[model samples]
Target: MKTLLTITLTSLLTFNIAFAQTPEERGLEIAIESDKRDTGFADQLAEMLMTLRNAAGKESIRKVRVKTLEVSGDGDKSISIFDQPRDVKGTALLSYTHSTKPDDQWLFLPALKRVKRIASRNKSGPFMGSEFSFEDITSFEVDKYTYKYLRDEEVEGKATFVIEQFPTYQASGYTRRIVWVDQEIYQPLKVEFFDRKNSLLKTLTFHDYQQYLDQYWRADRQEMVNHQSKKSTTLLFNNYQFKTGLTDRDFDQNSLKRAR
Candidate 1:
């Protein structure tokens, strides 16, 4: 009877030990596991940003600036500008995407006679003379990449999910990318970029996140560095407003020329 009781006690202890997990450990697990399921936070995030509409009851403005550089490998050189609100009061610079195809671009430069069109076909050329190709800038949308969970680790004191995102678009210059996302905020902290040859090309870091409208989060600054060239670009976001009555007409090509 003593031997049987001892055996039963051992079995119960084993079961409890296997089932028990601390809250932090559980949170970590959930955080990591969530990355493995369909639609990673990266995709969700991009979709959220793209689909975001100006809220009806809010009035606000956003300001943005993009600075570009040309690396040693390419002879192509150019700078582009864009603005939003399609009016004079608000100056929300939208995007400065670079390409070889006449540097496909639209600018709202108040000084210019009209919104200029960029039509260059150097698709494979480096952007701003940096290691990053033009394809990188035009790829802010979420549907461009497919994701998979790699592992979990701590980054800057917070448990994080390290996920690998593969580009789905045919025109992309990258083969894959690894991103680190904070478990609590679901915000991407860092990204490792890989070229078409599957080699490390660059690194991107996001910082200074601030909450807006109690539910929305925005990164105040973002920096991207080329591993090979040692050159980088830093983007700053200022005066961001949500639900600010933006319309489809605002994104129109004809409106570009008239933008302030």
Candidate 2:
């Protein structure tokens, strides 16, 4: 009887501990697990076609090449170079993202023959007149936000975990972002951004995901809709290549300026 009582007591204690976890703790756990699943894949290269649509349905398109390098103990580094749309040709954006610190970003312009550093506070501004802000393009780091598990729901027939993440970056313009992460791939299917005023700012949806290397998933298209501006931007990604053997030199400011 004494041994049985001891075992029963220990089981009850463990159950209580599990049920007592706060929403914030659970949310962080989910984020950490999701980040863990996406930790591999040393590098990636892809092409993107960005189409911007105005309230009146006027549209414009730009072709771009993107490169990404995964970093250990920190966020990823990415570089984007404009290849088409003669006017924007030779333009390049480079970023080194971090978990707790503000991201370092620079824009190179062939016409000006200069490289301009992006201010941390200006991370909220639009990126080249697109619905995506400078912050939107930066790599998502788990430590960049404080999270709270909102609930579990289904998004487009896929089971998803919904969580609210409040940005920890000082210059962030968003009050919070609600994310719906798919249960299987841990990829975010939908995100709703709220501005500083806590008003709905934009909604981003990921579609047509394809798994690469039989392990990693890549979305073919991402659409960002601006609720207030009545405008939207669609980025169609193509030709995803992994393990491209890219190094730090490929993402330096020199590379950005030298991009053609």
Candidate 3:
């Protein structure tokens, strides 16, 4: 029997006839709606503890602070500063994400006392020896993917819309992603990543979501597990503050080097 969501998509396609929307269009509609629901945060800041576990189950931890500014008509700008792990201490990464064009990124290395520009081509590489690639950590923009509705399913007892999203640009380590989005919140509950060769690579799960400003939802914890490598990274977010009046100046390359 077709579920309600499936029936709805089918009806949308059926009604349009010649101008019928494909599963892709219906999927994109869901994505756009999800994106719309999360808008208007203005800005936010959070502190995180990242735990990286190797195949042997040994773990190393790093402390970091993150700042993000929502863009008016495009993707957000963000800066992540590493405060722990003495060797990488005081290091920061600045990123300006665009919905349709290649993202711009720069890394501040205190050891070198200079900022290094990260080429778009290298965005697929591992970040700080963790399972997450630089591409995996960017702010999500709807235009970044071409989506197709997969099915309606339940994840961890929560009703979800399963959709397949294909990367619409280059330098992405993942060729595609299957996402399980919570029906009520419009936020993703889980995501399975496929490598460049379309092989299953990693799965990310979100937990302990709390809403802020009575509208925005932020997860307290996120875990990403690498299937082939048997490695994992867990990020615990704390002290989330929203609408803090952050601006573009706070995310610039120069500010990255000056981040304390």
Candidate 4:
């Protein structure tokens, strides 16, 4: 009888420990697990078509080529080069994202033959006239935000854990973001961004996710809608090639000018 009593007490203690976990702890655990599953993709290359729609329903399209290099112990490095539309052609944006520091971004304007650095204060502004801001384009790192688990709910037929995350970096445009992470795949299905005023600013949704190398999941389509401006931007991604032998040199400032 004593042995059985001790067993029961141990079980109860274990259950209580798990049930006592704070929301913040659970949120961080989820984020860590999601990040762990996506690790080890050396590099990636893809073609993208960006469509911008204004409140008046006016639409504009741009073609772009994207290259990314995974950085161990830090955030990834990425470079985007405009391909089509003669006016924006040869324009490139290079970014060096860090886990806990202000990200470095630069735009190379071929027409002006100069590289303009993106100031930290202006990171909140729109990127290339799109609804997505400069702060939105950077690679997501776990340490960049403090998280709190909100609740679990179904999002578009998938069970997801809704968590709220506040950016830890300086000069961020958003006060907080609520993300719906798919429970099965450990990837985000939807995100709602709140502005510095703590008002709902934008909603971003991912669609048609395809897995690469049986590990990484890539969203084929992403839509970002600005609630205040009534404008939206849709990114259609295609021709995804992973582990493309990309290197640090490919993401450097010099490579931005040479991108073709």
Candidate 5:
């Protein structure tokens, strides 16, 4: 019976090994899968209406046109140009997000007739007085953060995987972000941002997602609420056109000045 005992013990050891995945590994796997689902759309063009609400309930609106170009082996490049609101008209922001390095960003102020490079240390600041920070607008790259699987839950009747990710880059204002990723579309349904002190700072929720190119999903509306400041911003996207043949030259600093 010694051979039978050896075989049973070996089987038990194999079973244990098969089920030994840590939370970190599972979280990374989920992120990789999510990133994989929405790849290979050469470029995109869209328009957005940003509504900003202050603590006192005052409202301001900004109209913007967006262009994005996909890059292989790296993150995407995008530019946002303000079209309306006389004060901010002709202003633009260009971002070149990287997978493992600090993102390159530039802001062109029409009033000043110049382009200013955004410093990595200041990425956490709000973008044009909106609740969404500069870092928040950058393209999501899996390598930017370390992940931990939290739990499975349902968001708005859709099943989701909850995960916490800590930024691995420098000068990040957030300590951790909890993301609720929709199981069906493999996209983020909601995200909670925690400040450096580990306090809940803000929450961003996605709404009204529409599928494009038969495979890509895009959120038509996104709302961000700041808990401490009692401020909020809502972004409504429209006219999403894919494969617009955008090039790197369209995202450069020089392009920012000519965005108008």
Candidate 6:
């Protein structure tokens, strides 16, 4: 009888141990799992300043500075100013990207005294001679892609959740992207982009993260390298502000022509 009692007690103890994890703990685990599959590089924001540069050649460096303003459910508008290689001072490139349509791009050639619309198909072309394709300039949102959690590992001593995101946008050149996100910060650290043919195309890295307003995190710099072309583009971000009181009127089609 004592042996029987001991066995029953042991079973009860085992059952208790199995059920020790509460609903909250289980929910947290599920949330982390879901987060791995859904999180994007950045959340929605109002305005950002970016500087873009081409990979250095043997003799010179080429670069440009840009300011981007984004409005949810409308689109993004940007003003790009050429900065390097001396001959093109004061030249500006302006673009308004559409979520469901082809982007409208214009270039203000100070020397030509006109604002010329960039040809439509050229949307896939290089931007200002940089390795970055024009589509790269658009702000990335979570809705543009569908994600799946691939695995979990450690990066730079911090645990990371690895995920794969497939672009749903028709204009995107990439078929899929694999990202490594830090578990603690929920920020993507590395991304591998695959072309439409499923070939490895480019790798993107994010660094120098800073938290904003105690609620958001932003990466100060992003670098993208074309594996086949041996070229790269680096973007440095500055003066990021969120919830800047921007209105729907700011993102209207009429505003594109007047965007500074």
Cα lDDT for residue 241, model 5? 97
Point out the higher-scoring one by TM-score: 1 or 2: 2
Count clashing pairs, candidate 1.
20
TM-score of each: 0.56, 0.93, 0.90, 0.93, 0.91, 0.67
lDDT of each: 0.52, 0.90, 0.88, 0.90, 0.90, 0.65
State candidate 3's TM-score. 0.90
Candidates sorted by TM-score, best first: 2, 4, 5, 3, 6, 1
Model 3 spans > 4 angstroms off: 1-20
Better of 3 and 5 by lDDT: 5
RMSD of each: 13.3, 1.8, 5.6, 2.0, 3.1, 7.9
Worst lDDT window (10 residues) for model 6? 40-49
Instruction: Score candidate 3 by lDDT.
Output: 0.88
Q: Clash pairs of candidate 3? A: none
| Candidate 3 per-residue lDDT over residues 73-138, each given as its tens digit | 887899999987888888998888887678888889888879988776766788778888877777
Q: What is the RMSD of candidate 1? A: 13.3
Model 6, 1-260: lDDT tens digits are: 99999999999999997688654344345345544443332223333223344345322355565555654554566666665656865676766776556777777776666778876556457666665677666755555566666678887777887777776667577888887877777777888988889999989888888887675667888888888877677767666666555554554444434444
* Candidate 5 C-alpha lDDT tens digits along 171-238: 78899999999999989999999999999999999999999999999999999999999999999999
User: How do the residues 1-260 of candidate 4 rate in per-residue lDDT, one tens digit apiece?
Assistant: 99999999999999998999999999999999999999999998999898999999999998988898999889889998998777889999888888778778888999888989977566677877899987787777899899999999999899999999999988889999999999999999999999999999999999999999999998999999999999999999999999989888888877887778
Candidate 2 vs candidate 5: the TM-score winner is 2
- Positional deviation of residue 13's Cα in model 1 after best superposition, in angstroms: 26
Model 6 scores a C-alpha lDDT of: 0.65
